[model samples]
Target: MKNDRAPFPRREPSQVTGQRARPQEVLGLFATVITVVVLAVMILAPVARAATSSFVFVGRGNGHGVGMSQWGAWYAAREESKTFAEILAFYYPGTTLQAVKDPDTVLKVRISSTPWKSNTTSFSQVDLKPTVASGTLRKYASNSDSDFTTQTISAGVLVRVQNSGGKVRVTVDDTSVGTFARVDLVPGGSGASEGRNNVQLKTTGGTTVDYREYWGTMRVQPGDDSGELWVYNFVALEKYVRSIAEVDYDWATIGGAAYAPEAVKAQAVASRTYAVAKDGATLADNWADQCYRGYSFEAKYPGIAQAAAATAGQILTYQGEPVTAFFSGHSGGYTTVSAWSGDTALPYLVAKPDPWSLGAPPASMHSQGPGWNWTYTISADNLSKKVNGSLKDTSGRTVNVGRISSVDIVSRDTSDATSHAKTLRLTGAEGTATVSVLSFRSLIGTSNLPSTLILSVNGDVGTGGTDDPGSGGDPGTGGDPGGSGGGPLLPGEFYDVGAGHLYHDQISRVVVAELMGGYEDGLFKPEGTVTRAQFAKIAVSLHNLMNAGDKILVVNVTTKPFDDVAIDSKTTGDTSDWIAAAKKAGLISGTSSSSFSPFVEIQRDQMATMIC
Candidate 1:
């Protein structure tokens, strides 16, 4: 047992069962929960945003919108009762799960490389501290890991390899150790890959790209005899597989109930299979390959090791060869084709509906992060900048447009209930520009767009961007103020706040100016009560509008004025920033010295005082 950190109950290699008879068709696999899944999906909130004139996009899923969606697997296992093989078969169809012949095969995993010196094209040196929990450290002059001699040293020995005088110079504890063609830092006299204890690699102000403590043997060999070295953590395939932190294993603690274990077993097989397929120095230690955080992650999440152990020697094979199964965080609502990324489309990697990713048992909606069905509103000006920036580097595409006033979907490629944007047309002052949805996402950033699968501009958008912030079209220019019930209705006013209503003009002007807007569901809810926090945000916006040259922006929002108003990372911006601005403007004096009745309904006099 590893004594480094608290771990889950250890399971034997054969305990975690692999491969059951796969259902014939995809529909049959999820048929048991089909009705519930569909019904739950149908009630999902339609894409809505505040009545702001920005280009609001409403969509589903996240990640690259392809392969096995982690969110979908979570719902299928947690709520739908699907097993690991069943989930794997659903995402990667036409594939079979099989046990591998050699799970203990050695794997050279790239942990990270030393930073390339600036203003030069090559790396100079690497500084790493070698240690072990039980075994001593050794500087192997030859590739033979077990051939330990006088070079064997205790733990906490700092080793630095420098490229000087046409040879790899080795310095230990600030003294010349020796120079050799290949420098191997082994953990005791153990075999390079299958070791009893791991050689921990710690950064002593040397590496920056992926700076973290690592597991297994640390090997430093010249990349190509150019005095350049490539570093790797040489661990047995099983140890490397067990440390892949791909999904949220700690999620089981939610509601004091454990999440399904089979989902992680499925991931273990996928990660193991993906790793088994790679060779040479092409693989990496990031999401591009798979997030392999080595020992520390394995210690923190014992479930990862448990899953890998359970699925040891298990891999997904297509035909006879093992498959490189691709998985991602979320898939909006559908798994897409590899062709969507300009890669060779595989027969089994076709598009499929991933309803579980949308949400199931609506009560638990967004118990996961905001990836399910999310909304992002970008102003016309910002969209134009992203479009031009993307086109600036493209060889064939050129941008003549200034500020984009329109964003329209030209085509969509969907698998089922959810759709992904394929082509988008942007219109601006000078002219128009067309961009593939993939290119657009690459330009604007995935953090904002998340996934093209759910790209719906301006409310499941359709075509064209909104002329105003709100997608309800114009909020009407003309209305009889304080009218009991008179005058012709103008173009586009809130269903409740119309020409017949009193103070219609006042509401229209405010909505147009974006001083206020309706809920995300597009409802005015005029009769709804307002809290001090809500009114504070509005007052600050009004102040900014009046003082455009000196726009009021409150920095240091971490310093809170009211105890009730949250200022943490979850609520870092927007309302929090404006709330601080409101307090500074004397618009809101908390109910007492420290407490602000942020959620309590504001009285008419309090509203009147805020307006004053």
Candidate 2:
């Protein structure tokens, strides 16, 4: 109270009426400021860097970064605002987009249907021999005997119906079991068909044996029962197959003789030649018939020798029986062409020769980075009527090559990002060419696969014993494991509302493209836990389906009953978009607390809730 009016009474080293600052206080304030600055740098630096990395730098853009950047032309076009045709010409350079003058002249082939039959015997074929029980039988004394009794012994044969088709199907007995294409006989067990029976036939003379009839169908070959013949251009197919076989055989002989007895190599070549040269039915005589039927090498003309060689390589077994050398006329394009060819069974004509690699193919333009240039040449040897080619640049300019094949391009830019879009376009050439490009972006390419071959056995092993051929043929659409052709789809294939983040249309389109119009379920149930990892896998599979090599996203949002979810957590970057997209689509929802509970055992009801 005395000091209330006198600040100087207790103030020590104070300016006016204020108290002096402590040294630690001054240091603490300075430290706090420094810590915030450091933290900001730590957090913001990465984010800033990532943002800078996503951009695609611009450059001249006819699909040929070197030859004609169409976008550059388009830039020129926009400056002049050219016609679509003009735009095409600006990038294409020498090519012309002509109308199909005689489309019908070309032959088209498609697999109408694939039918399968079981080659294995059925349950009815087992030989069940009759055998009397060996146990002692007690016969009672008759007539005067007061007590009489008879002891009868019983024995059973074992039989089991093994559906060895390697596929799950509801059997005739209405039980689901894995069906194998080839079912072997196990014998002596209770099965769908009873092959054993204990019974005595009474005849006027004495006791007689009883016969039992067991019934079942034999296993058939795939694509046979339905009589769904896979049609192809008879002449063209024969030519292709023969050629592949011939090439394969010749290569094997030449390549192997260097390591084996000369006789063995010569024999292989002779056998292969004879097989292609034969004229009738058996391998010994079928060459002429094959040629007449458009399947032999000689019948295919300039294609004959090549076809025979190729066919021999494919069907003729080497000493080691390996696939022959896969040559690519095109250098940079071999890996791409081979991969696609292997799948479709398409033939590959190498598109690149050595030394001329001027740059990267137009397809690789978009992926190029700063300070690089590329040039490429494609060939016509690999082109087929159904195929079309394109040279695409990162700038969104695609030089449509139609069916013609030779091309070349060059490109350059100051900045690496800006350098990528330069390229060249070539058409009408084939056999091999070179492409060179300077770039930081990885190049990507694709090719088509060759067709498959199906061999069939003669039909009609007599009638009556066979199952009835219904309105649909044997092994009809109904029997297909992939699902019946031209019928409604399955539930699992359907789009469940609210349960998935994907739109029905988007999923349907993908399904149509992939599984080809068999996906069924239509409704979606939001506000439920999505379970059944199989279902999750399928849901997330769309990312790969759409973009091929890109990353995917996956997430879970359900109630809190499950202890797996952590608050404010996220999946890694690669799949984040898919997971987030799913969330945004109303396909997923959190548990009871409204927060996505990522780790919880999904219940059946929850599955239904999510997939509804």
Candidate 3:
């Protein structure tokens, strides 16, 4: 009997010939391994293994971890009597079972109408095999159906639609089912050969599914003509779930069952609404009822939404209510999301590690077909927001750029128009700076259009260029490389509100490099039209960049009597403080003109003045 404590006793190898000790050592090692295994078993006997508390029985197969499990669907069809609709519901759970709602979505089917349309056979007398015996349609077909052959068709098994005049049209269930392609229909058919016979199927959606074909022969037709009438008898090789925009809640499945306060539900609803609305949409429909697309938006797009969300608190506002939401998903499976604050960044963080970690496995709709692989991804929904923040060179100095006061994001998929909304507040002692607006739509091919990054005063949309802050030269010469006519910092150096330095300052090279990268030479244009929101973001960024490991200071923009201005609100950092400082320093004029157009492009002259 092996000793429970002795897993492997050290043993010296035989040194007889200097060669490794042969079979005996090998046997000894093998025995030692076995002894260790047995010892482990013996030692483990005293401590009972923990029993599995529960079995989740996640849906079969893999992929997006939502919708129907392709393999499960197939298995159910083969081993059980469930239909496609039933499979989808079983996997998706709380979803409302409904026909695919998109009109543009199409399902291809194949059918055999050849023998039935020969005219010699009556619809009632003709016996037909299941149509659409192969390809993509096979997934939706009956498990036992087989394709038609010449021997089977020539058997004259049932009602035969004989082509007496070589022309015949077979109508099934009041719809023409088939048509002979040639004018001379099989030697002797009835009408013209090129007309069509059709069959109409009543679907759950109250719409008639029509199957029609022309120029196809019946019976043991030669070379490619056999089984041609079954063009509509497709076996749904693949069922594509159409893309629909929606607001998906991650923890909603827990419901009240989990230990939480009643306010949690309210918060969940509010968050969901806020998220959807940020992209300019609303969530009237239940996301659970829709296909559990999982957290595709957050998982696919990382850093993008969180960055935007963190700034959203100070940027977007509507009717005194701060609104922010995220977006995700493309036509197929590509998805991303926008976050209005850092607090909402968790969803993306957790989902990114494993894309298909949620919901039940998908079911394959048919048997004997390859399983369909579903993919899910999450990313920052409003990338434009981050792009905007990065575009502005937020040196310590104040520019006329409009700072974001609050944020509101909307999901583009939902048409509710007003659900997604979130709020963020900037504090004075925060670690970072900059604000962004998360836009769901993509600017695929419109680079020439002016960018609506943070709204700058002088109309500069993105980063500075040759035109920004104007020419760096003497007033009369108009060609100096340095932007700072006589400011403390160099042309390419950044400046904080109160921080002072000489023309040839000894600032950190990183800040100088950033400024240089932002502009040519070093001319700080003082008369720039930086938007109110952009000024806030740039100020914070510049301060942080210069201090490196040091935190920046900011003051809040005071509440304005203007209907659109809400001063008390804060963002991720001391947004209020910075806004207030800028406002106090005459850097930004509050929204006195009813609305602050933050998206307006900046101008060279305006940039120069703002820098000044």
Candidate 4:
């Protein structure tokens, strides 16, 4: 939102005479009028020109160009007769497909919660009743002031849970029920972790809805800060996967027609693998994780359910452990490595050619999706505003490089037989600054720049120029048709040297190792000691890399190896799991027989020994 208008010139009123104006006076008046008109044109011309000046972004694809492309998978299945396994192999080159033996069949999903931000007086109510499938429902109530208390309710009983003024009140069949900070509903005789129970609820609008048949227990809690109500559902993994497939993929249409069964099946496996790899930390109803709308979504798309059932318990694995199955709407013409997508390079996630996205036969017969190729025209002033707003460097530090004057694509990757920009140089009034392609996309807005597989950036410099307008040219040339100059850094390369050691190549190598494994950011703090928790994560990553392609046994232990690294410890976050895994791998030992000094930092020599 830059103001590109030129300043308007001041105007003087014309002088009039009482009698007929003299010929010289008339001439002078005409000259003055002409001068005024010329001034107006001069003032408005640049504004008009800038208003019309637009940066034409000719690009292809959608979402981050990483892992599997959903559109590509669909095309492959339909045109090349590729099976689900074949499609997965084509995308995740070095990964294997394996079944999870005795995997946790149940998942706890937070379906509905009070809005993160709400007015002080705002409130919400939820009506609940047990379904026929669920027998003898019991409620466990708890609050900040009391322990959990249990009560039994009939299957057909109507229960209303309301939140107001940070207090939760419950009522059954119009009778006042006890108020509590939290409530959990489970099968009468079943433990919290046992049984698949279903519930029916009525919306505030009086619409009846049947939620998913959840396993384990359902928790209803008052929001801690927002004073809102939260409803959590514990559903079976297969059921959750089925619901997510429908939400993530267009079941009714892909390429303007019903999606092929195989395509849907591929989606099912990918979604299932993604959920299974979460290590029980993802919320079932979270869009950041997976979109799960409970039984309503599952019932609406019977086809999705069928697809999930067809691939039940199946997941994409690397070496025997679940692989991080990332998927996107499109790959623009080629798929890229994880590093290009702001992640560390993974052996299974290498860049590769995507013929499906190039529009393979059979699937190509239908109308193309919007993300197949797209163009956007944005004003230069607007572009500068966007760049000045939130551009950042490799170390996640914000960069204020003033108004952008030009943008040059410096470095690109052609390994996948497709060209994509990896580094971009932004020339502004303040100075020229270099940023990753991902950072540029983020600063300009993802919806505007879609993918890094850009064809050309026309009007990147100044107001007007005879730049090649959307030529879909080769990116490796490193030429900005818009008449700009700069060189790009090595693709996927981050960090030049360590902060403390001026010439220590070994420390830089360790930093590189950590970066490659997605452990450290671009900065290499060589003089900085490694914390116990940090070392645990590094050691675990190394262990995984050394045993790549082997089935890793994911241990489910209730007890912590060190009392300080307990599950609920605020300091550990999720690193406790890594600490336990490192101990199991014999990569680290506690300072004492039973205590792991998790907060203590290890010296450089000790870190070298541990790494060795």
- After superposition, candidate 1 runs with Cα above 4 Å error: 1-53, 113-150, 154-158, 162-167, 188-215, 221-229, 251-258, 279-281, 338-341, 360-371, 392-395, 415-417, 463-612
Top TM-score model: 1
- What TM-score, to 2 decimals, does candidate 1 have? 0.60
Please provide, for model 4 over 170-243, each residue's C-alpha lDDT reduced to its tens digit, 9 standing for 90 to 100.
78779977777666666543444333445454334444444445444666666665546666776668867767
* lDDT of candidate model 2 versus the reference: 0.24
Clashing pairs in 4: 109-284, 319-549, 319-550, 319-551, 320-551
Worst 10 residues of 4 by lDDT: 1-10
Q: Per-residue lDDT for 1-612 in model 3, tens only?
A: 000000001111112243432444434433443332233233322221111111010001112211222223323333343443343233222223222122222222122222211111112112222222210111111122252111211111122221223233333234443533311111112344222122322222233333322222222111132222212221110111111112122112233221112212222222332333234321111221212111122234222233223222221122333233221111011111222124453121111101111111111211111111111111122223333333322233221223322222211111111111111111122222333322211221112111111111111112321211211222112222122211233333321100121211222222233321223312222212234455545544444444445645454445642344455655533445555554444545544445433433333333344442
Q: What C-alpha lDDT, on a 0 to 100 scale, does residue 41 get in candidate 4?
A: 35
Error of 1 at 120 (Å): 17
Model 2 lDDT per residue over 62-155, tens place:
1112212211221222223333334223222223333222211212221111101111211211112212321212222322333333222233
Model 4, which residues run further than 4 Å from truth? 1-53, 112-123, 134-138, 141-147, 164-167, 187-216, 246-257, 338-343, 360-371, 395-397, 413-417, 459-612
Q: Kindly list the per-residue Cα lDDT of model 1 for residues 1-612, writing each as its tens digit.
A: 000010111111111123331334223323322222222223321211222335766565567766677766666677677778878877777677888767667777665432111111134566556544333345555667565444654466667776655556788779897776556665653454423333333232343343345656666655555556656677778888878877776633334244668778878888888888674344566655777777767777787788888888988888978776777777665566632334566655645445565442122233323225455667766677767745632236676678777777766554222355666777778887777777777777777777776445654345422211101111021111111111222332443332323334445545544556654433343433455677677667655655556667766576767777777545545566777788887766776678877765566455555543
1 against 3, candidate with superior TM-score: 1
Comparison by TM-score, 3 against 4, better one:
4
RMSD in angstroms between candidate 2 and the native structure over all alpha carbons: 34.1
Candidate with more favorable, higher lDDT: 1 or 4: 1
